[model samples]
Target: MQTKPTKSIYWGVVRLLGNNFLMAATDEGLCYLQFHDANPAAGVDEGAWSELAKWARAQLPEPNWVEDAEKLQPYILQLEEYLKGLRTTFTLPLDLRGTTFQQSVWRVLHEIPHGETFSYSQVAQELDKSSAVRAVGTAIGANPVLIVVPCHRVVGKDGSLTGYRGGLRNKEKLLLLERAGM
Candidate 1:
């Protein structure tokens, strides 16, 4: 699929709830936030920018990247507040890029309230594509915005945690965090 070229892309690293995340932004809005680990040899890892650049290269043409941690401060702050249970909804602009179907699934995912869970089939039914439960699962798996899109709110029909790109541990923690209102 063809994608528009963006003029600027910024990268930042922030810690929340004991985990480090790489935040990427553009003039349009926040694009990606990926999990990172600290480097034992040094301090916080700076490798996230390289990873972000690689992801951008595959998604866009000749992305102009800069390490502007400050540019993503607003998003980081909001996320911190969210982790602290001080916020239930995100107000940051999302530059989510995905197929039309994926976009629809992500949009519908937002309807799932915090501390609540919906089965994949339920999400499919909500989208009026009850037969596309697997497709809904795939879309949720492909969600680019992670916590911002709230894909973790999806569960198995039996209410069991299924899959999360960021891992089940993180997913479980997020659920518990929300459930405890912490």
Candidate 2:
């Protein structure tokens, strides 16, 4: 059976914290938060704006993409505040879509609290899925919302920093900002 394609409302792209991200909203809520330099030629391509949307769309199920920057203002402003150390928690509505297990992992990630770290095993234990430690790691790696979802808070059991899609530099900056109580 063929399922109908999901529709997407593009909230436009914005650069934040020396990185470029593409934010898109759906009727369900904010769906895509992608990291792509806006321009490789200019060397700002940590995650370019246009290329990100293409890549993000390709990764997820197809959606009828539309443009609407105004709807993205609140999220953009909140991100700016967080980067500036004036905000710690995100209140923006998120329409995160993933498999049931992935969603469960993401929800736990959200509860990790600011300025703290959790090991993959710790997260699995918290979810009472202790045997799924590796699965937990995979889910965390697949986190779509990045900082807002707090995947950067997950670390190796020994407290070593792990791989982050936004890059280790950005993760370090976030962890430092949180640790400084900024």
Candidate 3:
């Protein structure tokens, strides 16, 4: 039986950079980062604002304007601070969604540490098959969670910004933000 996709509210702040982000959860745990610039899957309703905010409030204990109190709020705040050069690292629990290989890539992305960036080729080598650079890019792109997973830190072999599902401008901004300090 095909149950219709339920409408879920994704909530987050419009960062100083003018981006709308929300850490949204499903029955499966925190599942996605809603980025305004990206084209979202149409099958899943984008959901209603007040409805989403209300739902977001219900799910998280101390929901921020971004919605949901779960660890995601502090994560966003600290990330905002970090982008402003007030923080060096992100300390928040994540609810990642993906296959084992994708999860493995995400784990590696987190440990990439603050202020450092890696090339797609380098990540592929770390994943154990140097030849999997393209696959690494795919996995990186497949990363549903941003910043927390730090996909923006991954760049092209030539140190040029590549396609960031979130928008390459966002990618460049993040890189510049990190390099500006730590």
Considering every candidate listed, which one attains the maximal TM-score? 1
Cα lDDT of all candidates, in order?
Answer: 0.83, 0.78, 0.66
In what order do the candidates fall by TM-score, top score first?
A: 1, 2, 3
User: What digit string (tens of lDDT, one per residue) describes model 1 on residues 1-182?
Assistant: 99776668887667777877877888889888867676423533656556666668766668777878788888998999988989989999988888899999998999999888899999999999999999999999877677889998999999999999778998998899899983
List TM-scores for all candidates, in order.
Answer: 0.88, 0.83, 0.70
Q: lDDT tens string, model 2, 25-53? A: 76666666756545423532443445546
Model 2 clash pairs?
Answer: 36-47, 36-48, 37-45, 37-46, 37-47, 37-48, 38-48, 38-49
Taking all chains together, the TM-score of candidate 1 against the true structure is 0.88
Better of 1 and 3 by TM-score: 1
TM-score of 2: 0.83
Q: How close is candidate 3 to the true structure, as a TM-score?
A: 0.70
Candidate 3 structure quality by residue, lDDT tens digits, 1-182: 99555544344434345656645654344555645632223222345344445544544434434344453555567667876788776665555656788887887888786767889988888889799888788899888767767898887888888878678887887788777784
Tell me how far the alpha carbon of residue 136 in candidate 1 is from the true structure, in angstroms, after superposition: 1.1
Give the poorly placed runs of model 3, Cα more than 4 Å off. Answer: 1-17, 26-30, 37-72
Q: Which runs of model 1 end up more than 4 angstroms from their true locations?
A: 1-6, 39-51
- lDDT score, residue 113, model 1? 93
